[model samples]
Target chain A: MNERYSRQTLFPAIGEEGQKKIRKKHVLIIGAGALGSGNAEVMTRAGIGKLTIVDRDYVEESNLQRQQLYTEEDVFEKMPKAAVAEKRLRAINSETDIAAVITDATPDRLEELVQTVDLIIDSTDNFETRMAINDISQKYQIPWIYGACVGSYGMSLTIIPGMTPCLHCLLKKIPIQGMTCDTGGIIAPAVQMVIAHQTAEALKILVEDWDAIRTTFTSFDLWGNQYTNIKIAKAKDDGCLSCGEARTYPFLQNENLMKTTVLCGRDTVQVRPPAKQQLDLARLSEQMQASGYQIKGNPYLISVEMKPQRIVVFNDGRALIHGTKDLSQAKAIYNRLLG
Target chain B: MNKLLFFAHLKDEAGAETLSIDVSGKTIAELKTIVSEQHGLTKIDSVMTAINEEFAEDDDIIQQGDTIAFIPPVSGG
Candidate 1:
């Protein structure tokens, strides 16, 4: 046994025997953003047997702020997150077999990936994607850990097939949280907090420590100084489309094709502020320049290139994000560059 | 006095995360009407509720001194 894992193996819960089990399980991680990056890094270092990460978005300098696995170099090259994750994880633990898939986590794509993995980790930044993952998890009976964070708030829950209430049951009404990292902003600490909970549960699951896994949906607001372990067993519904007897697997259906954005197909996403208003492009341009960003613009609009995406801001406060169709990610790029 | 907890954007709208309000017999839905008007939280109908740390439904009755928490979904990596 390599001394690299001696400390972990020495732990009573994850002894040498537990370490061996951990080293043999396959894990699939969706999205390679803050949560995904954190989960992958921890699991890779833990010497998981295999990890397959799928991410479609390219790295931006903005990501470097919290996405620990990325650096300025990755942003400069406009590398997709999955590809970059694989490179970094391999360097951290060569013993771990790392595979990266640089494509959208579509329902079909997820079904194929879930077939070979023992567990899934939900690190997506969109509701559609999470639903797709959840349905696939139920259809295949694979356990997955859910994690998300924005600003100083975060949440996580472990879903074991046939044991825990699935994400489908809990989201019958879909808590359409209007804030995204791009809109609400985020903190590194919040991301880490969720990661801590998720990875801890992942370890327990991998070691088959069934009794130790959390049964509650954990949530918190670090800045607000609040923590909660909400009882979610009651949220489990036998009539749930994903986990219910019918097992319709709605998310896996063709109509539920996980489109990155509601207004996708066009590479450019037009973002308008909450209340329609006029935008002073000149002042904003000056602000950008003052903030050390180079810009190109006319009186009507300002076009700024934030690597991997070009944002063109019109005078009416609407901006066109070219190069990606992910609405939340587009907003994030716009906010990071403009604000 | 019922201790109310807000989460995610609700916490932001609340200005304060926890509050003490008198909701002796209001149900979760009825309480939402009151809090939404006060905090300017729109479209909060989908938020989950936990009464005394246990999940509660829309019609679940709220008694005095119960600690209720409103948890909204978070979607960021």
Candidate 2:
């Protein structure tokens, strides 16, 4: 009876058997932002045997608001999020084996990552990357929990390969339009709420309480006081371009989506997703101004200057942003642009 | 007359658990218009809807007992 897990093992459902199951399990966690950081701390403390944390960004001063692993020193050092999180996780629970992957979680890399882990957890901020993870989860038959938060709102969903409808099953269409935390401003409490639910679901899966897991999508807005879940037992549609037809629309891997580049020295990145869709630039410009960014545009591209950053958007909704070197930061820019 | 279901943010935006409408339409497209007007949503073109638990096509006809659901572009995991 190790003192580290005595409290958790005391629960009848977990007891000693559940403690052993956790010690032998390996979990993969992508993204080390708000949700990722909090989940890492919670899962590690719960005695998860191995935690593989993958993140592409370095710590920034702004991350301290909700990113649970880093401090001002870590941010000033420009330490990669996975690196810093790994260091801190060991201190929190030295008995657990924690590995930090300091690279972008791309499709090619995903195959290797998924092959070794029993479960995957997504804390990513963008739709494209989440879709990629969803495809990999289905292909590997491993379950994953997706969690996200912004403002006073958050959402969480569990995906269990063949047993449940995949991410695409629920969201047939991706609105390339919506607000992001960076644009809308996020509160830390919302991030904690989302991570708490995601961590609890992971615990259920890890402890082998499959029957108690959530199959439907769950979302809540603490400040706004809204929460709900949608039933998805409906049969998979044949026309679904993803899970239904098993069509792997691996977004960024395809030329159909734009590409992103992180510029050296300038702390900016550029994304070049195919601009096949038309947009209302006039209305978008108006919205940008209303959201506090100064907007300037002609026909080819619209530039939004939001202090310390300059976002150049194209007619097809593609954008080249000059600010923040992290992939999540660039993705956040695109999320705001699309929104 | 049938019940229209909503999910996630759309359900939140709707502010109601479910909405009931009394209208006889033999097709899904007509039902989309009815739900959109009742929900005050932008339009039915960008939104996706299901008829009797299946993704409905523009020409797909709706039966009397089928349950219709309005699914907005999903942002969930």
Candidate number of the best TM-score: 1
Supply the global lDDT for candidate 2. 0.74
Q: lDDT (CA) for every model shown?
A: 0.83, 0.74
Candidate 2 lDDT by residue in tens digits, A1-339: 988789999988888999999989999998888888989999999999999999888898878987888899998899999999999999999988999998777777778887878889898777767777887887778899888766676778788876777777666544565446655567888888888889889998999888888876666677757665655566355555556665655543566444677877777787765546666677567657766778889977789986577888877766777867866567656764564
Q: Model 1 segments beyond 4 Å from truth? A: A258-339
Q: Judge the docking of candidate 1 as incorrect, acceptable, medium or high.
A: medium
DockQ of all candidate complexes = 0.57, 0.20
lDDT of 1 by residue, A125-174 (tens): 87667888888889898999999888899999899999999988886744
Q: Candidate 1 chain A: worst 10 consecutive residues by lDDT?
A: A255-264
**Model 2 spans > 4 angstroms off:** A238-241, A245-253, A261-270, A306-308, A322-332, B1-77
lDDT of 2 by residue, B1-77 (tens): 77777643456557764777664466767766665687754435655566655556666776766777665442321
Per-model i-RMS: 2.8, 4.6
Model 2 residue pairs with clashes: A177-A338, A177-A339, A178-A339, A258-A272, A258-A273, A259-A272
Accuracy of chain B in candidate 2 (TM-score): 0.73
